[model samples]
Target: MIGLTTYLERAQTGVWDLPAAFLPHAYFDAVVRAGGIAVLLPPQAVDDRVADRVLDTLDGLIVTGGKDVDPARYGAPAHPETDEPRRDRDAWEDALLRRAIDRELPFLGICRGAQVLNVALGGSLHQHLPELVGDRRYQLGGGAYSSAAVAVTPDTLLADVLEATPSLDVPVYHHQAIDRVADGLVVTATTADGVIEAVELPTVPFGIAVQWHPEVDSNDLRLFAALVDEAARYSAEHTARHSSRTRHPEPAR
Candidate 1:
């Protein structure tokens, strides 16, 4: 099963209700298209042990996009541009992500989720892309979906899995982007204005984060398919490991 972590959005009165929230259709479509069972992970009963067990049982993780992350996470002062923070969801997902990484689990981060991943790994973000990148047009008219061309790196895993040309026009909807990429992560794609559009940690088996919402784009099925494929691989390996352990009891010490 692919465990997709849902972001916690703050409600009135400083409360968070993850279970009551619904994920975007595009996110569900992408997971289904990838041929994996998508499970929405709420901020429910999450602790160190629970996180470890969840990571142990899941095949892959998908961090879905939502509101802007709290600036305090990356050691930056609050910016006026920063929107309402989702502290509950942020803390839950961050813990889950850290556990997933420790177990070397494959992960895919979308939009705000990508920012969380980058920040979790000691990376920083342009709190506001337009102000930082000096591109006032970066927001794409505040639309839900905007078309932007991303130049994919040929030698990266994304380029190989995508199996497409060096550059392709992808849909983008993001106000912030990765400024200083995380350690050991390489920028795999970027926009025409030189905004970091995608990133991948080469050392990890399968870690990719894209600024664009591939889930929303019908043409971007390949991205989800790749993630599902990885999930399946992880599942098969986990099953085999468990089976082996069951069949072959440990020898007497």
Candidate 2:
């Protein structure tokens, strides 16, 4: 099973405003395309016990893209360009990543998910990209994707999955990006503009995060497939461990 994170949004179905958990179908499509069961995990209060109990049941996790991570988390004031705070989602996902480190669970972070992943690892964000780049090469329009080529570090997990010299014209949309990468993670790819595009934790079997939305791209499902493939292995190993424990029951007094 794969757990995909979702956020709360206002959906107008009737004449009243109601908060609802929502996510794009592409997320579920990506998971299913990779031969895994897709389950959307809604944003909730920060409860470690609840997080652990729920997470322990899933083989992998995909932190979906959404609102910006409150700059307060990385010790920065909110930038005027930053989106409204999604504190509940931020706290929820942060807690999940914190627990993920110990479980050695597979994680694939996308867009805002990438930012949260970095912050959860004690890293910081730029808060706003336009200020640093001095141009809008990362995101073309307001929230639409702008195509750019990314140079992959040879022999890295990203390079292996991409299986080519450079990733060509991947969809990108963001105003904030990774600043000081977590010491635990290594840079795997970057754009010609020197912006961080991908990262992975060497300590874990599969801890990968990308700044762009791979799930949004209908042409390539490599990133999602890689995650699900690793997740399947995790599920198999976990089941085997459980079976062994059940067969060799602890002796009763």
Best by lDDT: 2
Can you write out model 2's per-residue Cα lDDT over 1-253, one digit (the tens) per residue?
8999998988767786899998989989988987889989999877889889878989999998988899899898888988889899999999888788789899899988888989998899987888888988787877678887888888888788787656666788887899999889899888888889889888999988999888888778888888889998998999999999999998998
Q: Against the hidden true structure, what lDDT does model 1 obtain?
A: 0.81
lDDT, candidates in the order shown: 0.81, 0.87
Error of 1 at 103 (Å): 1.5
By summed lDDT, the worst window of 10 consecutive residues in model 1 runs over 10-19
Candidate 1 global TM-score: 0.90
Position 159, candidate 1: lDDT: 92
lDDT of 2 at 26: 90
Badly placed stretches (over 4 Å) of model 2 are 14-16
Q: Model 1: how far is 60 from its true place, Å?
A: 1.1
RMSD of 1: 3.2
RMSD to the true structure for each prediction, in A, is 3.2, 1.5
